[model samples]
Target: MNPPDNPSANRWLVTACLAQVQAMRYTPAGLPALDMVLEHESQQHEGGGERLARASIKAVAFGPLAERLARQALGSCWNFRGFLAAGRGGKGLVFHIQDMQNT
Candidate 1:
């Protein structure tokens, strides 16, 4: 299916720490793939109250990004630019990372 005409509509930018990383694997097409978890914690104002927001999200990167992420140290923080999509079997959302930079 074709993507939406407005690319920014689905884009997601998150700043979080790398919580865990699995062994690098290859797709059937031989492209490198990496799966990992990212942890985010911050304080935000909601409903006129201060709230602590914490999240742990499942994420994946493909090809060169995957390879590069594999070499990064766990617990490192980064600014991740990506998009979200349903995972295999139409399960929960998975963040498909497109680019990242140290934070």
Candidate 2:
């Protein structure tokens, strides 16, 4: 099956919240490398502090509005450490860049 086109075309693409992410297991999509950080907060909470979770996901910037999408993905204190390709030939997992900085 063909993967969905315009994955980043939506002005607001719905994604799993941090809490939801924490509850699930996500394999990184590619080799653990530092491409960029994509972060975002939970809309469930009206302008409140963003809940911590796997909000960031390693992605390629070959798409349109790559920078904006990455910025939107990494919402607040969220950080991007590197990338890791998913075992299933999908996408890589995103690491929290803040983890390194906080140390």
RMSD of 1: 1.6
> What does candidate 1's lDDT look like per residue over 3-89, in tens digits?
789979999999999999999999999999999999999899999999999999999999999999999999999999999999989
lDDT of 2 by residue, 44-98 (tens): 5346665444354533332222323333422334232322334335544433222
Provide TM-scores for the models: 0.93, 0.25
Would you give me the overall lDDT of model 2? 0.34
lDDT of 1 at 77: 94
- The weakest ten consecutive residues by lDDT in model 2 span 17-26
Q: Pairs clashing in candidate 1?
A: none
lDDT of 1: 0.96
Which window of 10 residues has the lowest lDDT sum in candidate 1? 1-10
Give the runs in model 2 whose Cα sits over 4 Å from its true position: 2-34, 45-54, 63-88, 91-103
Which candidate tops lDDT? 1
